[model samples]
Target: MSSVATASSGVSTPNDTRAGASTPWRRVIFGAGVGNALEWYDWSVYAVFAPFFAQQFFDATNAVSAMLSTLAVFAVGFVMRPLGGIFFGWFADRLGRQRAMVVSMAVTALGSLFIAVAPTYPSVGLVASALLLFARLAQGFGIGGEIGASYTYLAEAAPARRRGLWSSSMYVAVTIGVLLATVQAAALQGVLTDEQMTAWGWRIPFALGAVLGIYAFYLRRGLPETTAFSNARDTPEPEKQSMLRGIWENRIAVLRVVGLTVGGTVLFYTWAIGATNYAITVKGIDPDGALWAGVIANLVYIAALPVWGAVSDRWGRKTNLVIFSVGLGALSFPLNWLIQGSVWQLGLAMSVALVVHAAVASILPAMFAEMFPARVRASGMALPYSIAVAVAGGTAPYLRTYLAEAGMPSAFTWYTILLLAVGLVVIASMPETKGKKLE
Candidate 1:
């Protein structure tokens, strides 16, 4: 655990000591990465399986309303994310990232268990819907805090020179989790009849999520607290200074986090969740085809993440942002049009867009961590990032669906382009933090 803060990057280095040489890179990555994967798996499964379970929790007569109810619950869960951030970010800052992450996973697992065993509308009426809402709220809260704690840990654990690459690992793990969920959906659809999937098969993923979450909790417990937090902990604090006060002191960095997150979160939800959901629900594409298409597209995204991470390290964080905003902005309309109820078109469009998306996705965690000193780093990033995601990202899928149902699908595409344009403006004002030292 012995370390020194290097002069150049202000990051702790082991100075070629035994600890440095023996740093368990694999365990560190797996502990952090796997937990992230589990978090997303739990989060994404709700949307992936919503089509099947929508009627189970709501009125069965109006199918569209039932689906909307399910998505609304999904959005409600997302809305709770900021509250998760406020509490968990403070917990991470005041206590430690490791503790916050472990506790959040427990809450998430409990939520999954609730959904796994929730009574259906036939038996319990609106009570079923209430249980679903309660479960989502819990999951949302856990996920909210999970992001700050995990991102902070990964950023601090990484060597300064390779921070960008390390940051990308979180999203790579995220894509894997999403891929696994899609795979599960495809598998269930392949094996079960529609009636059977709706009746029972949809519950399998939630039940498995609870079990996997427990295992992730076990793995995370073994991870060491990062040197940055340990060092920050020992330093004297101003008497009675609160986490919110510290975040306020770093207000500019907090604003930057919001701006950096806004467009990327929206872009991520659109391609990752909205597009597939759209193809199935609106375009009438086969569920298996849509989910399988997502699998291939996600794989392409995974491969692109590391390459973009390298580019960010060599060029700068701002370079990646520019590429993401402009490239995705220009291609947004055509990609939207490409999803015409076919598996190949859906696969091609998602693959191309996600490749462009990797630029920003690869470096966001590092950029946010680097923006503030360690004292308020977790909270500073957490609040604004969660707020942005809740406001824009959480609403993305619903908005896309609503627009398409209104026979104005092109409007949603325009909305995406506008956000990307705004993101470009934010990128222009952003400092290049490629090799910057974390405080």
Candidate 2:
């Protein structure tokens, strides 16, 4: 197996060369890392500031209502992701991945800037919330497209046998972004009173994200497109199918990707978002303590991602998915039951659970990309994944809160387990894509 790196001009296609000869693995990983870090930095800022933003932007008569409103707006962002994915994915396939990346990052930066400068409800009333909504939607659209383009570009540019190792950088960057958000939230909580947080401290992270977004844009400006896309474009253009038509044709693959995504995204929100709330509201831990727990657990998961990806490269993508599904399904309920006593204990349980999820997250890009040809791979992968994210991931935190309020906190655990079991069934039906060529 061989791979090549396409220069940014959209004209030069370099032949496959070793890490020492062409663009080094370090450079490839750095570019992918910076872009992914910025992407998740924007996302993590929203999750971290949800409670505070709720107070500032929505009617904050009750704690529950505020949190619920925040999550509702968060869900709205996921709804726009697929549209961004389709538009940018098609653009990437047509114009070039480098161009697609530049546009996505630029849009996300603008969105973050909008959120940073937006007024509070007291000043602008409904229009304040409206501006926040538009910003989130814009960020959602950019993120929806960014991941597919970055993943495909990195995976295709890597050494074939070690693609898993190289591609794992994406999740590592995501974990770092999550960690940054957690730490920033913790730091703000330490310095500011709750009143101050609700007043203005909450905007700091968004402001920081806008700065990071600018840095990411400059980094991405130098990134080359992937050779696979270049070669595909050099050949005669395939009949450009409508997004809906492509989804209809690839229904089975779409279902499989959705199934896989549901488990991964659910676990992500449960650990990253729901767990933080659980620590504060249920376990009586301080907000800073809860943020620290997430930071530690995510750091551990980030360290583990590449190892799992390499294991999948050797063992098979299906094997990794099966293990992830079964392990997470059996363990989620037990872990949730055990997370009440100590912050350390909660962090340990969350770390263990997320390791199972890392197995899936680490290799999903390659697996999804392999499921379809280049013609529709971006839309095919992005739409189903985003839809599942909106339905499952976007709802996990809110649903968990509702279940807790209904005096059935355990029900949330059962729900996640059931989703993992369903994902296992879906993985069973899909063929193993280990070592498959990206045809």
Candidate 3:
């Protein structure tokens, strides 16, 4: 065993190894994956249902204006992500990953519940809007913490050689959550009248998300703490340093997290969240067909995740990241231009873009976790990563919508290409850390 692994593992006897080995893989994956699914599910459903709920909480005079207002609230939620990361990351380091995860899930569920029960604009006037904003802020905070804690836990708990493969489960769970939202949107659209959907149907998913969050919280509470965190807790230096000092000590890695995420998060939101919106709102595709196509595309994304995870396991993390940045940089514009309003075109474009995205998405947990020692891994990664996603990813849908509305849709395409180019440079500069032992 590597020195780091041995230290993290403590002075393990044969019985200790046997005990660790006996823990079911199903439990590990579920504990981490379910909460992750809840986070993405809530986010995905918000985007999926935003068109339906826009007038419920915002101005009803102009459809486009209301949609933009709803999306702005979506962005507002993301604004809270950095704060969430800081608080939860610190809590994870000071407490345990398991406890932090449990609390995040609870908070996320509470946000969903608030949204589920929130009054419509007609009923409560602008107070409805304020409540919606608060709900999103709470959800953002929960998801922010959820990302850092979950990523850190998944990476540290995996077997050294299979960390990439194991880490891919994070996005597998995420994609599944997205798929669920798409499916629900399609189902709801098919069953409900347009008026019904706009009025009350939009709240169903949020209510369901709250229930699922409760279940995820239960699962996460059962998760065993990672050995790496246990070891870090025992280290005197790490124990003595405050969260800010610990993060400052690892400032270089923090910056790398920001640089690495800038392009990836933008691309992620572009396809994963915004593509359906683009098709329905921009290209005027039928909502039902576009959402179903989104379902298929999400399935393709899910299937591709573990494949790239396994590929990164063999080919190295840097190699997969280079492919992701370069491939996405080259293809983004062409793919964006390819969508000309047909459902099939939208599906193909989304599937192709997401397949490329899976390369980085599959390995992010492992890659980010590898960059820092366990002592500060969650907090070190949380602030920068959340900020990057907030700035780039959160704004993607709004920017794309605004640009397309202005008759310059290609401008957003170029913006994505530029970020991907930046990502390529950062990827080139980063050292390969595949199979590196965790501290």
Candidate 4:
């Protein structure tokens, strides 16, 4: 951010490059943000369109069961996240961060394209469902790799004092992606007939996701390697570069990442994704209403991200994490119960929930990155965080649906509360790294 010049038109563009720096910090943030956006944007596309996908992929059995079955396939992506993290984390650790992102983006694009072109259940039978699962697994692998690499990139590239503000781009861009998915789904519901949406209209969003993934690849390829990564390249012994060896050496830091992420992912998925599904299935709100609620809440969430990050910069990361854990644990049950019926009810509930979660989402990348040195940063961040997402965030919708269908919706609420309590304990036990320079 030193001596950066801006446009005469009063708005800077990506073309505005630094005169002497290797790469402008703004450009680095933009490139990293774009990759994060594509990852979560594709993720929300599936969540927003789950109902349409369920109809197209399964025979007309019990409607709820079919949707749950589809979500189980959706969980397949989550199931692969830990493995993807292991692979991609090592790939990033060995190769450059930019190179890892380019390949990850392609995996997402190909997977999305596969889904966009998949046939209906009647046309291809169980094979259609299999294709859907394959797509999710591919996307899962892509995004799993995406989070650790991208987060490490941002944390490494930013200036020391402003790291939290820069890393907040992760959630700022991700929330924009979430909002786009909801807006696209809402527009489709409003513009298309139900039959049209169920038949072919549902494919438009996935096709668009494919296109964004390609663009993300190009953006990432242009990014220069982080200074930290470049400097640390020759320091580690050859065998230490093996991800398993690094993870073993930094096992404590990795476990802390997992613990910190468990409550945050549960809150994020529950509010950002699970709430939409609940609004439609449990409360019987129309698709349009649920989607619109998602859109509004996500818009608000995007704006709140950097604000929360700034707060964490002053108040401390552990403080924000504690607030997030307590708020979600205390509020989820009542807020979810109050989210029945009207659009205002659902929208208001999600917006409030998002306010609490934005703190965690904004501060998390910086917090995790602060835990380890550049050599093990990517894998240390990825593996533990991915495991938490798989266990808490990925299966949240299915678990909520399943529990509700089994006539025990409150059970899901209690389960979430239990996890948040565990996260709170971890937060209390963790070292506060506010303003601490990355190793």
Candidate 5:
């Protein structure tokens, strides 16, 4: 347990010299990434299989209406995320990062497990929907805390110089989780007929999530509480304020974090999740093809995130975010149009859009975490971030579908672009956080 004294500030920072050249930062990144992946995997299974689940759960004449119902449930899950953020953020700050992570995963695992085993609409009528909603709420609760805890844990663990690279692992894991769900859908589609898919194939992904979540749980068990959290707890008076009070004091920082999160979440859903639905329902691509395209594009995103993160570390967080916002705004409409082209064209469009998305997603964890001090870091970062994500990103797919059904497909794209523009403005106004030590 060697330590380094900050030359400028004279504050002691823990140096991971226990295993020379063997970066503990890597472990921190992997643990946080894995946990986030599991959380996203559990939630994403619902999105990827929404059409099938909608049909199974709700009886509606229009396919869009049924799908809307499914997405509404998905949105409900996100709406609960802020509460999750507050609860788990406080718990992480008070109890320990590892303990908070374990609790979050347990809640998510239980939710996915419930969804995997729940009876269908035919068997249980409204009760089935009630159960599904309850499950999603539970998962949302876990996720609310999961993200902030994971982000703060990784940011605090990494060296200041490499925080961008390490934090990018969170988005890398997110894309990986998305890839896993798409692959699962593709694999399940191969084995089951349309009839079987609607009947039972849809449940397989949820089941898989439960299994994978259990594995993640086991892996996370061995992770240590972050040194920052430990130090915060050990530090004397005035530093020991409640998480809520700290959040109140840092309201402006929370708003800035939320503003940055809005564009990323919206564009992410628009290109990744919403695009999959649009490709299948509007553009007439086969469900399997759409699923495969999503999988491929996500793979590209996962590969590209670390590169962008490293660049951000070298350049600046605000610069990378501005680039991402501008690129995404310029390319979004065209990408949607391209999805209506040939399958190869659709794949190309998605890949490019996601690569652009990688710029913001890669650096967001570090960017947001750097905005607040450690004592209230998790709550300040998680609450507003989750709120923006819930309102903007979570609602994008459903809103886009609704507008499209009302004969305004282009409106959805415009709406996304507007949000991106606002995000860019926010980024322009904010300071670059690169190399800033989290105190």
Candidate 6:
């Protein structure tokens, strides 16, 4: 946006523009990250609170069955993500990022509010389950689009040299959001009796998420359009083409997006999201203890994020991802086996896994953003990434539950390993995007 351009290592660093671009990158990152945190805050709370609330939504033979059913509904939210991505990506690509993000946050807030006040199975029979599903669908759609817009904005707004370090804010915000969810649940557990939690206490987190979304909306509303997007928006088209056709022409990049996400999302949701519950269920840890495990582990992961992100800034994004894929693939089973013990074991396993996962999580925004030009960046990244999450990450918890009930939780470790291998292949084939100029 500015005449002052940097070609250090052939990278074109973003410069401030007077038209609509904002400077001092910290505000840009904070504006984008806050909304993302609220979206994930609602998402994580559901998974963590499922055990207490599952009975309210389903009639089942046992607690496990009820929890499994709730998780299946959880997976339902994921199924809607790709559709959300397509619609919202098209909107963001055509209109503006700020509009797309604000609306997504509002819709997500509405979904959480619905869950906060949903009736129980006894009060409304199967209708209660239907309400939960509807709420999740709205959330899934909102969050699906939230990712594409937020990542694109962060990548575009940051200085080129420090992009990796700045972009890691997304995961940092997510870890904080997840930590808050766990802590809230833990604190509530202390204050309320189990019967009270089952009856109504589970709703507090969702209610709180809805309020947080309001603040997120307020922060994001004032963000100026990024110089990258503005430049793309202002340039004359070389040839007239539909956004869908453009995306179709870049099918390989789209597929690469899916490949890039498969392992990261699977490994992330399986261990990061599912581990806490796994501790309570399979390992016989107390619920509060399991919640505390999640809280403490996320705190450590949050602290380590900047360190790994800076490493990717100097070393390479591909290097971190390769380490992530190889480490997770080689160690999933051993880690799974290790966590099959006490609260300390669960905390250790989650922290170790997240520390490894940080290699990918910290660099993913820059990696995917670098894959596509600014013209179609949001749409290109959103569609395929959403599809991958829907297929892999969305179902990880449910698949683990199903396999565990079938007496084969260890089998999931092998499944994760196979996908991580595919990710490694994708990573190896892709060029090193470190310091590569955004097209």
lDDT of each: 0.84, 0.77, 0.85, 0.80, 0.79, 0.81
How far residue 58's Cα lies from its native spot in candidate 6, in Å, is 6.7
- Model 2, position 423, has a per-residue lDDT of 88
lDDT of 4 by residue, 6-107 (tens): 211234334322111456667777788886787777877887688877978887566798799888887788888888898889888878677787888889
lDDT of 2 by residue, 5-28 (tens): 332122322445222234455666
Local error of candidate 5 at residue 236 (angstroms): 1.9
Please give, for residues 1-439, the per-residue lDDT of candidate 1 as tens digits.
2222232223333432111124466566667777678778977788778999999999999999999999888878888899999999999988998888899889888999999999999999999999999999999999889878988887877666677887899899999988888788778888899999999999999999999988989988877787778778878755436887888888888887887788898889999767787899999999778877888899999999988988888888888999999899889888888888789999999999999999999998889998888888888898999999889887888899999999999898898888888788777877777766554
Clashing pairs in 1: none
The sequence of per-residue lDDT tens digits that candidate 6 reaches over residues 192-292 is 99999999999999999888888788878887776666667777877535678869887888988888899889888877788877777777888877877
**Which 10-residue span in candidate 3 carries the lowest summed lDDT?**
13-22
lDDT of 3 by residue, 329-361 (tens): 889878988898899999999999999999999
Regions of model 6 farther than 4 Å from truth: 1-23, 51-72, 118-130, 237-240, 404-409
What ranking of all candidate models by lDDT puts the best one first? 3, 1, 6, 4, 5, 2
Which portions of model 1 show Cα errors greater than 4 Å?
1-23, 55-68, 121-127, 280-287, 337-342
Give the Å error, residue 309, model 4: 0.6
Clashing pairs in 4: none
All candidates: TM-score: 0.89, 0.89, 0.90, 0.87, 0.88, 0.88
The local lDDT score (0 to 100) that residue 99 gets in candidate 6 is: 78
* Model 6 score (lDDT): 0.81
Q: How close is candidate 5 to the true structure, as a TM-score?
A: 0.88
Candidate 5's C-alpha runs over 4 A off are 1-25, 50-72, 119-127
